[model samples]
Target: MSSHADHPTVIVGAGPAGLTAALCLARYRHRVIVVDSPGAPRNSASAGVHGHIGMDGVTPAEFRARAWRELSRYTTVERLEDEAEGVSSAPDGGFRVALGSGGTVQAGTVLLATGVVDVHPADVDGFAECWGRSVIHCPFCLGEENAGGSWATVADNAELAGMSAVAFRAWSEDTIAICPETMPGLETARATARSGGGDVVTGTVRRLRHREGALHGIELADGRVLERQTLVWTPRQRQQPVVQRVADELKLTVDEAGFVAVDASQSTGVPGLYAAGDLTSRWKQSVTASTAAGAAAADAIHMAALLAAVHH
Candidate 1:
């Protein structure tokens, strides 16, 4: 077992990205500590992860467990149930990472796998009322769960209304793309929806309607109500960094999406700092997220080892 205090790299987040990064760093004999913040829920937006290449159908629990089981064999790795709050530079050119519980991690480097989140109205008109059971975000994750049942997509981005429609159609036989415009693509979308046993409607969704905790309909802005069992949307990705204030202190470059800019190895604008996973707009899939993490961890370990050799 590794002493948590001895870890050279402190990783923030315990999701697929963070866990994968931790395993990679541990393989290089770098003591690693993983902090999840609130941890992951079973019904998390990401139901399962992919892109493991050799491993598929890896559930969240199984993915973490297998990595943890193996990471323990290589070097010191500790899984802590704490939310990383902030990080700053140390006088000796190392780093100080703080947690919500007032715990601190002293390290030569920090790996931020804090991931991105798509914001949705919290239960507006009872949408929250049917989440997980009926209302959902990803079609690939929940389409089969409601197979043969009715489903619809809410158009948030006018430009990508067709994207959601096509995604929904590919997932289920019954799908619809809801938009305010009766554009030419709607016909194509509608036809595609029909091929999947779905339809297209034009209206602004006011709220999701539910009864007995089951999704039954959606309320429109004009007061007309449409009945549907499921609501889907391709989230406009929003990236939130864990160290926004500190980034400015360190003069880091952030993109318009608010993600820390990175190179091939996930090195950021600041030295001794790296980022990976959903933190960048690389892609929204679990596989890409994990791969980014591994890349970042490998880079961190390599860089740290090189720095240590220089001093020696």
Candidate 2:
């Protein structure tokens, strides 16, 4: 039987949250192993990290590279460029994390920082090309850069559309909500939009017209074209597979929106299993917020370990 190596903590994702936790734990002289796979970060298409103090406008790739560089200073942190396949309870009152590349690591505590995936509008053509650029989701993340431009929101529901239109007026005066025919409460949404100095157009968006990744406008099924330079839509999001797997394996409580239920300390209520970042939050999905959550989880783990040692 192959023996599994042990660590103080194991982080399942190496995005902002995971990296931050690893850095914090390492700085405190705790041994941690981070398992992550390339091309899995959801923000790869984003041009830069927005609303993050000091690191604002830094590209996602650059931000991760710099974080890894800083983490290299600590010998206690080990980063594996591999996917975390599964997690199981270990005999020693810990957890065993299985890596896709083959091997297992026993961890006294586990921090799942795996983020969520954005589900783009499948019916809208050319959306994939303009995503993270001209077609964005979060207003706070990409609104300032495209301020003053013609903005529109393709919302899934009337309430969301109305709310988005109102919020978008801060960025541009000419804000409109492209309410699809399937959306409910169209009149209410339109009223809300007009109240906020915006308009609501009920139509089926056929496709997005873009040239070389720059959005030109959106074409409607009724052959109407809305000449908008920028489009904002709140895409549906789903948790990553690793997050769901771990949550199920450990029987962690998850909210209706599929976010892991965590306490103020980022604990999942499953003893040493913790979760942070987008996997556990939806309101504030920014680099700064995720990093803060990671740091908080790390501090909690460190304190728990200290108490355990003292009692021992």
Give the per-residue Cα lDDT of candidate 1 at 174: 57
TM-score of each: 0.79, 0.94
Local accuracy by lDDT, each model = 0.67, 0.86
For candidate 2, give the lDDT of residue 158. 82
| Model 2 vs truth, CA RMSD | 3.0
What's the CA error at residue 117 for candidate 1, in Å?
3.9
Residues 1-312, candidate 1: write the lDDT tens digits.
Answer: 332223377777766667777777776666777777665643353445544566655666777678778866764777778877777888877688887898788877777777766566754677656765577666555666666566787763444554554566655555667887656566666665555455678887778878855788888888878877887755455654455755666777878867677777777756667777766653454555556656666666667666676786
What is candidate 2's local distance difference test score?
0.86
TM-score of predicted structure 2: 0.94
